[model samples]
Target: MPADLCPADAALAARLPQGVLRDPAPAYLEEPRGRWLGQAGLIAAPRDTAECAAIIRACAEARVPVVPRGGGTGLVGGQVMSQGPAPLVLSLERMTAIRSIHPDEGVMIAESGVTLHAAREAAARVGRQFPLSLASQGSAQIGGVLATNAGGVNVLRYGNARALCLGIEAVLPSGEVMHDLKRLRKDNTGYDLRDLLIGAEGTLGIITAASLVLAPVPAETGVALLVVDGPEAALTLLSLAQARMAGGVTAFEMIAGQGLRFLAEAFPEMRQPFPAPPDWSVLIEVGLPDGLSAQAALEGLFAAGVEAGLASDGVIAQSGREAAELWALREHIPLANRHVGAIANHDISLPLSEIARFIADAGAMIAAEGDMRINCFGHLGDGNLHYNFFPAPGRTREDYDQYRKPMTRRIHEMVVARGGSFSAEHGVGRLKAADLAEWGDPARLAAMRAIKAALDPVGIMNPGVILA
Candidate 1:
């Protein structure tokens, strides 16, 4: 077992300019899902990269475990160490700074603690767009975003967090700073250490700052909500939109009727675009150049979809305000889901062709187990789905707690059988370490273990994460 932070570490705490908090508050111990309540003897917020390095060095020397924390907005238990020795929680909250912005070069260097919303606004100030967006953008920090390689709605066009990051400045397990914050578009280095560390979930190293890629603001943008027949029809509509709009399709999200119903039940004030939610519908956004009209493109796609019988009805946003309102609905679905409570929540991805089949099969499999409510929705453009299970009407999640484990296992097995990932954007954290071990290829698992041993031999960096 790893050693806990004790009074002997007072000298190291004194060296940190930002100081340490001995009492781990509810904010530091609890995760968003409330699945894990962590225990920590010390909570240190470093003001700078050097201070972060010193704290890590002290932990390494003392052979004490250190859990790197960000905004604590992670759905998984990555930010919290649940069942381990009381460790030092190193938070990057104090290091929130925009180091530099190069609008001409389309890049920005920001400290890890900078929230995604701040980064987006910074890019907007320079007339550039950071493109990466999520429901948690208001609280999710750059470090945690890149660490888990998050994928959100815009991932259909902008790619994940790993793609947005060009380089990172990180502190290794031994307290050595790996300063490779280059804005270069092309770097032919021996090994891509930046890529390795980005999705490592702080198990390899803790990212302090990053150089991120930005995009030119779209000249025209529009959002459309289209009613589809089912997952198959949604897929057809996606292909049609891609064929018609090409690179203009910025986001293609699918929402099941149950999700819309839940939104209505939980948040009655929020306007529903459709009078009655279709069994399956899609929210598509298009970003076009100056000459091309996004509204026209969406109308064209809608007309084609209707003619092809892929879509039954649709509505397009008439203004920027309308577009944001439409996005607000999409973003608030998760909140509605939380209010309803979930028995099992899954974030999985499948090959584009297998999505419809997997959804159909998984629904059937879950139905066989029990009469549960399933909300199947997500970024259909990129083949990632939030396949969540909830209690039946007039029921509570606790009433079905006994089935959570078996239902999750069934879902994961079906996903893996269909060549889908058990954990899509959510990192392995403490929750999915066993799933990773079971589904991960033996060769890849071995290589990951070796890399962890090489970079964090003492396992001081976020212990019990990614690896067992």
Candidate 2:
């Protein structure tokens, strides 16, 4: 077990500009899902990279475990330390800064503490778009987003967080600064360490700042909600949309009727677009160049989908306000899910060819387990789905607690059998470490262990994460 934070560490904390809090508040101890309540010996929020390095150095010398926290919006409990010796929870909440923005070069350097929404607004000020978006954008910080290598609605066009980031400045486990924040698109100098830290869940090091790529705002943007028969038809519609619009398809999300129902039950004030929700529908967005009209492109795609028998009914946004309403429905699905409660939630990805089959087989498999409700939706353009199981109308999740593990295992088994990943966008953290051990490649696991040992010899950076 690692040594606990003692009185001596207090002196070390005082050296930092933001200082430290001995008594951690509820925010530091709790996760979004309320799955795990963490324990911390000390809470240190550093203002800059140097103070962060100093805190890490002190923890390294004392062999004290350090848990790097961002905005605490992680679903996988990566930001929480629940077991082992008490840890010093290092937060980057105070490091919020937009260091620079070069609109001509299409690059922006931002401190890790800046929220995703803030970053987006910063980019918008210069007529550029930071395309990495998520439901938790208002609170999810850059450090956490890059740590987990987040993938959101715009991934179909903009790619994941890793692809959006050009370079990063992180503090190593050994307290050394890796100042590799460059605005270049190509660099093959040596090993790509920036990628190694991103998606490492702060187990490797703390990402302090990043140089991110920006894109010009779309000349013409359009959103449409189309009713599909099922996942199979949705896949077919995706193909048709992509073929018709070419690279203009920016976001394609599949939503089940259950999600719409959940929203009605959870938030009655939120307006529903359709009078009666279809069994299965897709939210599609297309961004066209100056000469092309997004509305015309979507109408063409919709007509093709109708002729192909992939779509039954659809509605294309007529104005910007209507587009915002369309996206609000998609973005609020998670909130609805949380309000209703889930027995088990899965963020998984599969090969496009196998997604339809997996969804059908998995649903049948889960139905046999119990009479549960499933809200299946997500970024169909990229093959990632949020498959969550909820209790029956009159039941609660606590009543089904005994079956959570078995249900999760069964779903994961089906996913793996169908050439899918159990953890897609969400990193392993402590929640999926055992899943990684069970499903991860043996050689790859061994290599990861070696890399962790090399970078964090003392095991001070986020113990009990990724590798079990």
Stretches off by above 4 angstroms in model 2 are 1-23
TM-score of 2: 0.97
- The models' CA-based lDDT, in order, is 0.90, 0.92
Measure candidate 1: CA RMSD.
2.3
TM-score of each: 0.97, 0.97
lDDT of 1 by residue, 1-468 (tens): 123545655655655555544445689888998888998777888889998888888888878789888888888799898776778898889899999999999999999999999999999999999999988889999999999999999999999999999999999999999999999989997899999999899899899999999999999999999999999999989988888877889999999999999999999998998898789999999899999999999998988999999998998999888888888888888999999999989999999899988888988888888889999999999999999999999899999989999889988998899899988998889899999998899999999999999998998889888887
Candidate 2 per-residue C-alpha lDDT over 30-109 given as tens digits, one digit per residue, 9 for 90 to 100 = 89988899988788888899988988888888788999998999989899989998888998898999999999999999
Candidate 2 global CA lDDT score: 0.92
User: For every model in order, what is the number of clashing pairs?
Assistant: 0, 0
